[model samples]
Target: MGVVNVTQSQPVASMPEEDRKLSFREKVAATIGNMTGTMHNQIIATFLLFFYTDILEISPAYVAGLFLVARIIDAILVPVFGVFVDKVSTPWGKYVPYFAILGVPIAIFGWLTFTDFGLGANGNVIYVTATYLVYSILISIKYAPSNAVGPAITKRIDDRISMGQIGYIAIMLGALFASLAFQPLYKALGNGNDARGFSLIMGLVGLVGILVSIFQVTSLKERYINPNNSQKTPLKEMISAVFTNRSAVVLYIYVLALNLSNGIRTAIMIHYFKYFFNNEGLVVIYGAVSILPTFLGVMVSGPITRRFGIKINVLAASVVNVICMLSVMVIPDTKAGIIIFMALNAITAFFLGASTPAQGSMMPAAMDYTEWKTGKNVNGLMGSIQGFVQTLAMALAGSIAAWALHVVGYVPGVEQSSETIFGLKLLMGVLPAFVLLFTASILWFDISEEKQKQITKELAERRQQKS
Candidate 1:
């Protein structure tokens, strides 16, 4: 075992040897698989709270509490799933075997959440809560494995960067498709019953999620498994590793802030458009206008990260986002003003979206640091811990948004006071801007490109000697 090689700078991508480069097919398959996971997330984040509040007539407080409960359950379970992944090995692969087992359950539970099932208000809450827990647990089980694959697939930093870029592009595309399809699907299927529409849409999306998940499982190739290491990491040790790894800890805090902000923004957008603007249809238009620039962001993220370094790229993008969001907040609420503001928001999303790949690529490097320091490869633990933190942040945001809505005297399907409108504006703009500014400032990762290169070279040497 060697000492941990943590450094105090962002790691830039370096060209891998010829043998280490991933095939185009492999990259596509991973991207598609990642897209499926993100699609599920997009649906839940962007629409779930709105569905419960608006269509089902659930109080925002109840729904927010439900979110809180589910996330807490998930946060507790995340590390257990990580340990399980580390201990398990099978014919399929160490990381992906659970994918096949969890696929059907994930799909079934995901679709169930949107259904009414003739349950009364109290009964519906119970049903929704139970179903959400199941779906969240399944996601916990599956996401760590999928995320851990980048490190398992290759030791090459550039390959990891490439994979992260492709994976985030998949995420953007999935969110894009959801945004584009949601209004149309709800309109066509629900007619007057939006509840039914949402259920059917989720059903279709869930099935696609299952198929693409399976596709991702089959397509991925895990090349860096430690053959001699079959022992499961103890819970205590996993906890120790989490705090001990400075890079991982910093990332946890960073992602928590980012996701919390996103959760608030997404949970309130429909409300902002529907109640505040008095034009619910504008939600669709906003989604449509935002997609092009967001797509452009995903397209260019790889080149930008490679050239300017991930930390610089993310910092610059986030600074621009802060300005854009503040601009939106100050703009008057006219049709043209809103359109222009949405366009600017689109640019903000572009910069924000561009930061994702760089953020993701950092985790594998963190895992490398953990292993180099502790003599144990805890990639699953690292990934799941991040997932756990993100879930917690999202829960915090959801609950806060819900309570804020209540405090502002928001009533579903009714006219709101000026106070309510002001709160909605804060959720959409100022709150998120402040949180994002914090996100940019704290992204000073402690792993330089040079240090990462050294870590990788040493890890390879260690593995070779073991083999």
Candidate 2:
């Protein structure tokens, strides 16, 4: 119970900042907070595309273009958010303030994004476009500061990796719970209307999400960030620092690919199960079967990375993903094939979850390198780059799902042709496998743990010298 009496006023300043690993309570608090903060995004990601194309009768191409536009705007604005986060200073601390300020709005906008206003087709599109753009922008703003807090909390690479592992459990758990409950919750609330169900359930979940995110302010602290460094790095300089750092570029691409893969798989998941398998309920079962293996993968990630190194674990996950995804095509379209598909999904889920920690830790490691190289602690700006990659990836993936659906001749509430069936599988299985190739760029990321150790030591010494 190494709990410090941390309040908004003196968050983390009481603790000696140098290489300060978090307490057990602090770690638990961070995990729970992260789980809550991410819930809205999970809801949107897991079901929104399906909601748009299937329930609302929006054209798949239009839906795809809409998703793409929102995320593209988000991608561009995220770095500006990073710069804004860096420029701002307050008594509560740079990162913590965002959680408190944006918490309620995130929930509100999230629920709004899921809403189906009975406006005619034109009104619905206009309303949706406006709400989604607002929600998309807020997510980028919230996550910019939210992600910056991790690096601010500590400079220890092991702690960063450990936190990432724990954080991923929260991420997957949020998704698992959302996937499991969305159908039942919506149906019960809306009396069999999917639009009504999705809207009501998201509202309830958003309320809970905001409360937990706000409570996070009291448990976590921003120890490493200099409260007094009010000098804002120009956007041009922020861009230069991030691009010039080889590891940052690699990690950005890594983030983009990983997020894009997840976006495509999830955005099109309901369509796959509902049409291709004619068993939409299998979505919940898929989430259930994925739990044990995915959690086990997360549990083993720390040990695996420590023993074999992060690069190898990430590469291995990528390779496993390709093999398992491609193997899905060979499964016969029968009841037995469902079990085989799920089993393959479980294997893929495990590796994807396993690689999360190794993947997430790279961002902060890259940030440290940037700070060392430029003598500028632009953690907020750098964290936005991570967010930017995700925005861009999701943008592309969302559009890909829609375009593929439209091209393949998908129609709601009808029997699909074999070609459409093949197209669905390709979007779900093959496209994600291809996106995982983005990891090849990571081969150039030579920032080993040993390398990080020296950078950590040198940065600390330099900070001490400056003080």
Candidate 3:
């Protein structure tokens, strides 16, 4: 018994040397799964409003309402689902089960959202509201759980960071496809009718997304702590833990700022393309340029996290973003000038992509901090608050964008006023830059990598003793 205890005590000299480094196949599978999941965001953030307003002819005010109301509903669902994820046990894993159950339905509803059926403006609004709300809820089901899985898959901070980078790469690829391909596909299929063409493209992409998620669930393994045997705490206790847990609160606030900034940029994209650029087709060009940096940044995220720490990386990215965004105010909006500005924005996105992995690493650290301090793994509720805050940010961003457009005298189907164009430019550039700067302040987190390893080592010993 003494020898066994000693053997267990020192499983390895240091972190077991990661005997099961992710193989190429596993990395590819993980990337595909992550990319599929991100289709939800890219589609929502980049395309949905434009699809409704310009293609379906829905009112901008109504579009804003749909975004706000649907997110509210989805936010309500997050805590409930988090509780469900905590209590449930499955063959695949707690988080993977959601992908199995919700992935198909999410895809189906997404398909319905794009189909349109040639409904008039009012009818289209009603159809879109119902389908989009359902889609949003379904997305919450998969997203909340999958996010928790990141920590569950690995105890090593470095491995988790690597996984996060792979996931970000996948997400960037999805964004790239959505931005670059959707418009061209719509043009080919709809023959100049954007509404029908875009719908068809979304339906096809939805099918692909479902398959990717399914494959992800089947291929991946959850090898770290099992939620089933982990310590359980009540919701109130978990909520309290989040406040006391400094890392958790900082991460929550940081995510809120990032989402708010990104959401503002997404909400105003159509207006910028149509009014400021004087061409709707420019949406594709901007989208491609903006997303390209994500691909470039993902390659270096692991090394950056290793060298500079997560908070510093995030701060550096935010600084770069602010500088690039402020340039828009100085640079004239000529074709060449716009392209140059877009290129600079893309560079900012590269750093933004690098920061995402850092953010992901922080969540698990927060979970560990809670467990280490309270002896309870309240990942589900912790994840719920994270989701809720992020969704709230999105809702606020959408409302702000809608109100900004209204204040600037934006009127659909008419040539936009110069004031409206100015508003769009601000929304595209300055607003997001300022929001990111503020969020960077919130990322004054204290969870260094070495400290995180100590927590994990202690937690593993505790688990072994109980066993």
Model 2: per-residue Cα lDDT at residue 87: 78
TM-score of 1: 0.83
TM-score head-to-head 1 vs 3, winner: 1
Number of clashing pairs, model 3? 0
Candidate 3 per-residue lDDT over residues 230-254, each given as its tens digit = 4345666656766788878877877
The TM-scores, one per candidate, come to: 0.83, 0.82, 0.82
Residue pairs in candidate 2 whose N, alpha carbon or C atoms collide under 3 angstroms:
186-197
Q: List the residue pairs that clash in candidate 3.
A: none
Off by over 4 Å in 1: 1-19, 44-68, 111-132, 182-207, 227-232, 271-280, 406-424, 441-443
Please count the clashing residue pairs in each candidate, in the order shown.
1, 1, 0
Candidate 2 structure, TM-score to reference: 0.82
Compose the digit string of candidate 1's lDDT tens values, residues 1-467: 33355444443343344137788777777667666677778788778888878876788998878876776777778878877777677777777556667776788887898777878888877787788889878876676776677777776666766777778778767777766677788779988888898888888987886776677677778776784342655667766866788888777777887888778887788898887678878876877776777767776887888788877877787788778767756767688877787778788878866777777788888887887777777777777877777777877787788887887788998888888888788778898888876675346577876777778766666665565
385 Cα displacement, candidate 2 (Å): 2.1
- Residue clash pairs of candidate 1: 7-446
Error of 3 at 129 (Å): 6.0
